[model samples]
Each structure stands twice: as structure tokens, then as C-alpha cells.
Target: MVTSEKNIQMIMELADAFGPSGFEDDVLTVARKWAEGLGTIEEDHMRNLYIHRKENTGNKPVIMLDAHSDEVGFMIHSIKPNGTLRFVTLGRFANIAMSSADVLVRNALGEYIPGVIAAKPVHFMSESERAKGGVPEISSMVIDIGATSAEEAVNRFHIRIGEPGVPATKCRYDAENDVMFGKGFDCRIGCAAVIETLRRLEGMDLPCDVIGVLSSQEEVGERGCKVSVKHANPSIAFVFEGCPADDTFTEPYAIQTALKKGPMLRFMDVSVICSPRYQRYVLDLASEKGIAAQASVREGGGNNGAIINTALDGTPVVVAGVPTRYIHSMNCITSGYDFEETVKLAVATVTSMTPEQIAKF
Candidate 1:
């Protein structure tokens, strides 16, 4: 069994990898390496990694733990006449958070070119313009690469249309306070939980087959899970994710979720209504095991949507997520305690289920 420190190191490695929506190859490499010697691993055409372990062969319902490998990023659209690059967002991005942010532009040769999201200078802008609310439109945004002309910029850096650009940052751990700060924690944390669980379950005597899916294109709309669900055909599934915490000094009701509260057991989401029976089962398991957990009612967003109705012909689906702050932004934060709880909850929930128990749902 891997230690908590090793699991945390794996998560940090994943968070540092550059695997935006359509470019998940690098992240997959790391996942594949960690999944070795644990189970049967495969990568689909869509770049989704599926790791399966055949423990009990009694026709038990398959259980899948899903997490997306992609993060919010951008794609280059055009090179401007003045050497600045015009780019379009690949996934959801908070435009207000894009200003003055450093970004990494991945060229065709797999090199990282450093650039910063350019914004209009306050000195040149009128007070009225500065007072305008909300983020500026994409048309008004450009990436500054320190080039004086388009020719020089293109020659020095292979900036082309459709290349992926990600936030240029590294995962940082605060040893004194035991906090980790990083980008892409939204789903990376979830991915880490899935992988850690798989590693933990290695060689254990279990009653059912378990599948670990590092899904793709989730930030684009859970498209990768749609494919994997169909292929694995799991009877019961858990979609692990990181939910945005509403803790910016907001009102109580406005603060939808919070960190360090264990996994949030989502009852309903925008895409999928979790099976009542499975929700109860998960809650009961957490209670029985004395695991830290929180109940959530999400109106929108969760991967349960794709898993519940997509493949396996209406299988029971449950969502377990860690509360994250500033989701989809460059500085998403999550508690290490919450992350570890998510892993424990998933392992316990899956280990406790029997074929009959799963099929009843």
C-alpha cells in the first residue's frame, strides 16, 4: 500500500503536468506509470485511461471510479500583426481572472513558451472604461511574449493557431501550515483520489471488479466519461470531482460548499439525479465507518450525469467531491484532508458493496 506522502506526491505531479482539455497525453503518461502492476490498463482513442482489476469473478456488478484528466486552458487562434497572439479558451475560464496571469504556450515541438495574458494599461484607459464591470471580451485579450514584431515572435516561438496554452505555475506545499496551493486541482485532485484508491486496493481480496477511469474532456462537458461508461458498463459508478467552494466572505446560503469537510455527497446535480438508493447507501457507509462527509444539493455540474444514463443502461451513479475554492480559475485550492477523505470514502464504499447489493439499485 502506498503511503499518504506518496499519494500526495503523485497528486502534485499530476497537478504540475500540462494536460488541458484536448491535450491529455502527458497526464496519461503519469497515470499509466502509477497504475502499473496494479491492474489491466488501457488507453482509448480519446486518450482516456482505464485501469481494471479482476478480484472476484462471480459476475458481480462492475464499479467504476471516474475522474477527468483535463483542466481549463486556452488554444491559440491567431498571431497578431504586432507579434502578440490571439487565443480562444479551450474550456471554461473566468475572464476576470485571466488578466495579468502568466501562461504557458505549448508549441508543436512540445516546448513551453512563457507568456502573460495582456490587458490594457490603466494609464491609457479612461476612468469610465476602467469602471466597466465584468471581464473583458476575448477579442480584447492578447498574450505578450516580449516580441517586437510578428515575424520575430513567430521565429523565436512556434506560436501557431490551435496550440494549447495552460497557466504557467507549479504546485506549492506550505509545510508550516500543511496546505497545498496549485492549479488544476479541480479534477486533478479527483484524479489523484482515483489513482490512490487503485494503488491502495492492489492485491486486496475483493468481491467485485473495479475500474479506475481517468476521463478526458470533462471540462468540455464530460464527453470522455460518456465513452468510458459505455465501454466498461459498470453497474455502479462514482464520479469523483472537486466542487467550487462558496467561501469568499459570502453569505451562508451563498457559500454553497466548503473545504476540509470531507467528501461532499451530492444528491442532485444539473446533469444527473443520483439514485436515491445509492445515495442512501453511500451516506450509510460513511456513517457506519465514521468517515467525514457533507451532504450537497448541486443545481448544476457533476459527472454523474454522464455515468448514470450513458452506458451500462441506467446504472446507479453517485458523486463524491472535495470542496475546492476558486474552481476553474488559476488558483484553485483544496484541502489535503478532504482529498484523503474522498479516497477513503470511495474505497470503503466500493469494498463494502456486493454484487447483489449493487444490482438491487
Candidate 2:
């Protein structure tokens, strides 16, 4: 079983791995290593990871767990005549946040080289350019590794076209406040939660079979999970996420996903509307068990749940979201207590269920 120390380490290692959409080999390495004792691991060309619980029995209903592995990143598009590199975003990025952000470029040799996203300095900008600015166009940005010419970048740095990169932020845990600062919490934190959940359920005998899926390329439109759903073939799915927190920007009365509020159970997101019966069941269960939780009707977000819910003759799905601040940026914030409570609520949901109750959904 994974202990507290091990879980913390796993979360950090996952956050540190540079996995950008199509290049998820490094993140898969971390997940595959930690999922060693769970069961046999399986994958396809898309790198969608899956594991059946060790205690599963063939006759029970299947309960699938999903957490995406890839994080938003950049890909080298071209090399300039000067030493700087031209790039394109691999997934969603707040364009304004790119310039000056610390980055690690995976060179042609597969080694991560430190670099910084660069743009024209203010002093060098024309009066006309200065008048039309609000973070320059994404296409105008470059990654500078202190090279003097394009030839230097290719020969000395081994930088090339098509290589992917991620932010260079490292995971940091604050024990006193239980707040964790890191990169890729959007789904890496969810990935950690799924693995830890599997560990917690190591030998438990329930009326259902459980499996965890760490899908690839989620940031690029849930591409990996569209394939994972066919593989897991679950009767139900619990999609976990490091969901964006609204507390900071939202009005007090409208804050639906707040940090340290256990986890958010979505009623609806752009991707899917949760199964009403299953959603209510989990909400009631959380309240009865005294688990901290929040519910929301999201206007602009989607997840693996949408794909899984509609797959394989219609599977019921729920999302257990860990509220994260500033997702898709170079850094993010989440709370350890929120992760613990999210796991607790899920464990209770799994153990307290039966085939009869599930049929209601």
C-alpha cells in the first residue's frame, strides 16, 4: 500500500515529469512504476494506461477510475536565423503567461534543457507596436536558451523541430498549511489521486471491480480517453481532476470550487452532465459521512467524464475534482487535505455500493 510519504513523493514526481500531450512517455513511467502492485498494466499505441484491481472478481460490475496524464505544453515549430527558437502551443496556454515563464525544452537527444519564453523587450518595441500591445501575439514569441544564432541552438543545444516542452516548475508541499505548489496539477494531481485510491483499496472485497486509467493527451481535447473508454469497458466511471478553482475570481456567493473544500462534484460541465442519480447518491453520501464537498454547474470546462459516460452502451460517470488555483499556467496550488477528503469520499462511495443500488443509476 502507498503510505502518506510515498503518495506525496509520487505526486511530486509526476508533477516534475515533462509530459506534453503527444509526448507522455515520461509521465507514464512515473505512473507505471507506482502502480506496480495493483495489477497487470495495459496500454495501446495512444499510451492510455490501465490497471485492474488485484482483488477483482469476474462476476462484479466494473467501476472505472480515470485521471489524465498529459499537461499543457509547447512544441518547437521552427528555428530562427538568430539563436532563439520558434514554438507552437501543444495545448491550451494563457498566451500572456508564456513570455518570461521558465521552460524546459526536450532537445533532439531527449534531454531537457532550461530555457525562457522570450518576446521583444519593451525598450526595443516601436511606438506603433507599443500602442497595440496586451501581451504580444503568441506567434511572435520565442524560447531563448542564450544562443547567438540558429546554428548554435541546433549544434550546441541539440534543439530541433517537433520536440515538446513543459514549464520548469517543481512541486513543493507545505506541511504546516497543507497547500501544495506545483505544475501540471490539472491532471497529474488527479493521476496521483487515482493511484493512491487504488492503493487504498488494495485488498478490499466489494460488489464491484475497480480499475484506474491514466489517459494521455487530455489537454488536447480528451483524445486519450476516447480510446481508454473502449479498453476499460466499465459499467460506471469516476473521472478525477485537478479542476480549476473559482474562489479567487468569483464573487463570494458564486464560488463553487474553493480550495480546501474537499472536492467538487460537478452537476454539469461543457463535456457532460453527470448522471443525476449517481450525482445525488455521492452528494448525499458525502453529507452523511461528513465529507467536505461542493457542487457546481460549470459553464466552460470539460473532462474525460464526457467521453467515458457515452461509451460502451452508456456508462454512468461522476467527477471527483480537487480544486486547483491557476491551472494551465506554469504553476498551480492545491491542498493536501482536499486530496485526502476526496479519497475518503470516493472510498465510502465504492464500499457502500451494491449491484442493486447501481441499477438505480
By TM-score, the best candidate is 2
Model 1 / residue 177 / CA error / Å? 2.5
Model 2 TM-score (2 dp): 0.96
- Cα lDDT computed for each candidate against the true fold: 0.81, 0.89
The TM-score values for the models, in the order shown, are 0.94, 0.96
Model 2 error, position 104 (Å): 0.6
Q: Write the per-residue lDDT of candidate 1 for residues 1-361, one digit (tens) a residue.
A: 2226777788888888899998999999988777777777899999888988745353757788888899989988888889999888877887787988889998767799999999787777877777885347766899888877888777878677889988987988764554678888878888888888887787787777888888898888777877888877787888888777766766877555677768888788777788889888998889898888888787767674455455667888888888888877777777788888889999998888787887787
Superposed by TM-score, candidate 1 places the C-alpha of residue 277 at a distance from the truth, in angstroms, of 1.4
Candidate 2 lDDT trough over 10 residues, lowest sum: 1-10
Residue 220 of model 2, lDDT score: 91
Residues 48-123 of candidate 2 have per-residue lDDT tens digits of: 8988898988678888889999999999999999989899998788877787999999998889999999998988
